[model samples]
Target: MSTTTSETGARVVPIPPPLYYAAALVGGVLLDRVFPLAAAHPALRVAGLVIACAGAGSAAAGVLAVIRHRTTIVPHRPVATLITTGVYRVSRNPMYLGLALLVPGLGLLIGTWWPLVLLPLTLLAVTRLVIAPEERYLRQRFPDEYDAYRARVRRWL
Candidate 1:
């Protein structure tokens, strides 16, 4: 979903995180096609697959936790609850963290360096374009509760 202003229902997250990650993955793969930087070993590629799976699992767990709580998963949307259980207990932004990990893993799995190379930019974009705004909204909306949660949980782990 697109970001909305404070006056509208949802507010401040500039873009959906999935879109950022997807673009990174696709762009990186395309860059790999042009640059041709293949992984050096077969084991590394396998490792990438494992990492990708783990990332997928983590992201899925986060999504499930949100669904179980019956809250909106959309970053821009107004949150109904402060999710501090399940996947959220470990990281405040598990879904983003998962996708962040996933993009690089996919790059390695594909035997290329571009995704890993592009990962930093992906993170920068996600943090600035999505997470930062969402955090602002959360802190503004939940104040004391969000502060407590932030105090205890790491942003990413």
Candidate 2:
């Protein structure tokens, strides 16, 4: 999807990330269902809440940034603007970063330690599969401009 509104007449939709995010959440939920995490250890309840809240905050920041930019955050879709200001300055892929953070938060909240393993995997998937391809596309689409911006900013800060 080219960001040039003229190239793609239809409005861009937010592209969902890879299957692992959903898979991680579902697996976490299922594990919690079978074992029921916080029933025995009340202390974990507090920790879970904090982690989930942090995730929510990160996700909210990404969503707000997207809304402010008035474009899709998904890299596969064409980006109307580069959006180097604000949150974009900190992390090139905040939405994916936020969602990556969210998976562990969910696992933490559910008290399912096993599913938390997917946290690193989520980052790897986003970096290698999702973000890498999108970066290449962006570079091709916006060569010099994107390269200059990339030099200044980190991909996953």
CA lDDT of each prediction against the hidden true structure: 0.83, 0.66
What is the RMSD, in Å, between candidate 2 and the native fold over all Cα? Answer: 4.4
The TM-scores of all predictions, comma-separated, are: 0.90, 0.74
Candidate 1 residue lDDT tens string, 27-83: 988887788888869998888988899899889999999899888888766677889
- Poorest stretch of ten by lDDT in candidate 2: 5-14
How many Å off is the CA of 77 in candidate 2? Answer: 2.6
Q: Per-residue lDDT of 33-52 in model 2, one digit per residue for the tens? A: 78664333566556666766
lDDT (C-alpha) at residue 3 in model 2: 57
